[model samples]
Target: MFQKILIANRGEIALRVLRACKELGIQTVVVHSTADADAMHVRLADESVCIGPPPSRDSYLNIHQIVAACEITGADAVHPGYGFLSENAKFADILAAHNITFIGPSGDHIRVMGDKIEAKRTAKRLGIPVVPGSDGAVTEEKEARRIAAEIGYPVIIKASAGGGGRGMKVAHTETDLEIALQTARSEAGAAFGDDAVYIEKYLEKPRHIEVQVFGDGFGGGVHFGERDCSLQRRHQKVWEEANSPALNAEERSRIGGICAKAIADLGYSGAGTIEFLYENGEFYFIEMNTRLQVEHPVTEAITGIDLVHEQIRVASGGGLSVRQEDIKFNGHAIECRINAEDPRTFTPSPGTITHFHTPGGLGIRVDSGVYSGYKIPPYYDSLIGKLIVHGRNRVECMMRLRRALDEFVVDGIKTTLPLFRDLVGNADIANGDYDIHWLEKYLAKGE
Candidate 1:
């Protein structure tokens, strides 16, 4: 086991990793920007280092400074808690070259799965189902039009290296294809420095289902079930639930087994998520996240697994602790991503938190790195916390979630708590009858 681990991110995730390390009796070193001098993670860490200023490029994303911090602290491993450098293949390679461990998959695996185009190809090769569309990048107008016609109208153009809904456009007919291609290409180039784009058949309404898998870098792997992240706004998931209300026990087992076998065959290590678009009882591969997801708590809540501890163990050459049959899904779990934003206007709300109160009770958990009197820095993501609830079933879970949202409070700044309160009371959300586009349509109707 590593004696010390350096966390290379901030906010709630940083604090999440710190607690995991402490539980395993490992010392922790947290790196923070000047803007996070008073952050909760820094305060609770065994040691803290100020890397740079507020800007992410100068601080969190600065590879050299992070490496220096590791060297100075004598940290042997780095647990990049999502975002920033978590999926950077180059960063993982650099750490390996310096004799430091990266508590995730190898750089090679990250490189293959990071690119959407290559990930699709790999998924298909691994016997996983995929959407029917272009074979590869559609470089020319003629090719884009051809693929759209072959796949039928209503195709989505996506950046080969895009995420978070950027560099994506949908064309309902042939007339819209040209402009959609141009816009997607331009956005892709600007956002990812890569003009490459691909075409895929767009489903009118599909639930976002993702299977969580873990590997031991050997030939062993297991899956922790699926999360229904269908609720979204501008492609960002607002709410997530485990054991997707859409799938039955048979469907869950089938998809989970496929993902587990794929990870085992590929010799992947640590935590990874295989995301898919599900509609009409069919699942189509979308992309793979090479690191822990922002919505991991819901999965943990259902499976009772300490994913961070497993990551540390597997990275230290210990094989998987649990077998496939040893894993059992227990209950329904939901997670609400509480962001510092206007619930109605959807604008960023960054200011001091004057009064803070979190809900408490059985089956309710709040993971946050903020407190009263703490200032929310605008330079980073506006997400201040995640409220996860677990119950014996979906109905009980929703009831618990509603009660918890009502008790959650934050003052001196706007938050999306009201939005969740309204959503919980809606008929569609109550019945678990929602898709990826449901949230956007709900907001458009001002319901």
Candidate 2:
């Protein structure tokens, strides 16, 4: 076990990792920007270091400063709690070269899975189902049109190195393909510094399902099941549920087994998510996240597994803590990502939190790094917290989630709490009859 672990991020995830380390009796060091001097994670850490100013490029993303922090604190491992440098293959390699451990997959695995084009090829090669599309990036307009023609109309152009909805454009017909390709490539070059784009058959009315898998880096791995992240806005997940309401026990088992086998075959390590678009009883691979997801709490609630604890254990060479047969799914769980934004307008709301209150009882958990009187800086993400609820079944889970949403409160800033309240009461959300496009359509209705 590592004696000390440095957390290389901020906000709720940083706090989440700190709690796990504390539970395992390991000391923690948290690096923060000047803007986060009063951040909750920094306040609660065993030791804290101010890396740089408010800008992410100068602070959180600065590799050299992070390495210096590790050396100064004598920290042996780094747990990048999502975002920032979590998926940076170069960062992982640098840490390894410095004799410090990155508590995730190897740099090579990160490199392969980080690129959408290569990830699709790897997924298909691993016997995982994939969307029918181009074999690789299509740089010329002629090739893009050819692939779209072969795949039929309504194709989507996506950046080879894109995420969070950027560098993506959909074309409903051949006429729209040229403009869509140009727009996607322009956006890709601007956002990721890579002009490479690929085409994929776009699926309508598909539910976004992602399977969570963990590995010990020694050819052993297990799947914890799936999360239905179909409720999204602008490609960002707003709500997530475990043991997808859209899937049955058999379907869940089949998909989970396939993902587990893939991870084991690659000899991967730590936590990863294999995302797919499920439509017409078929699962088409999208991409893989090489780190812990923001919606992981829902999975933990259903499986009774502490993923962070397992991540630390596996990274430290202790191997997986349990066998595949030892894992069991227990209940239904849901997570609502509460961001500091206008519920109706979806504009960022950054200000001091004057009053704060969280819900409690059986089956309710709030993961946040904010408190009353804390001034939320506009320099970072608008997400302030996550509310996760668990129950014996889907019905009970929704009931509990509704009650919890009503009980959560934050003042002095606009928040999406009201949106969740409205969503939980809607017939579609209540019945779990929603897809990736459902939320946008619901918002368009202004009901």
The local lDDT score (0 to 100) that residue 213 gets in candidate 1 is 95
TM-score of each: 0.99, 0.99
* Model 2 lDDT per residue over 1-447, tens place: 999999999999999999999999999999999999999999999999999999999999999999999999999999999999999999999999999999999999999999999999999999999999999999898898889989997999999999999999999998899999999999999999998999999998999999999988999889999999999999999999998989998999999999999999999999999999999889999999999999999999999999999999999999998888998999899999999999988999999999999999999999999999999999999999999999999999999999998889899999999999999999988888999999999899998
After TM-score superposition, the amount by which residue 350's alpha carbon in candidate 2 deviates from its true location, in angstroms, is 0.4
Over 4 Å off in model 2, which ranges?
none
> CA lDDT of each candidate?
0.95, 0.96
lDDT for model 1: 0.95
- Clashing residue pairs in candidate 1 are none
* Candidate 1 displacement at residue 137 in angstroms: 0.7
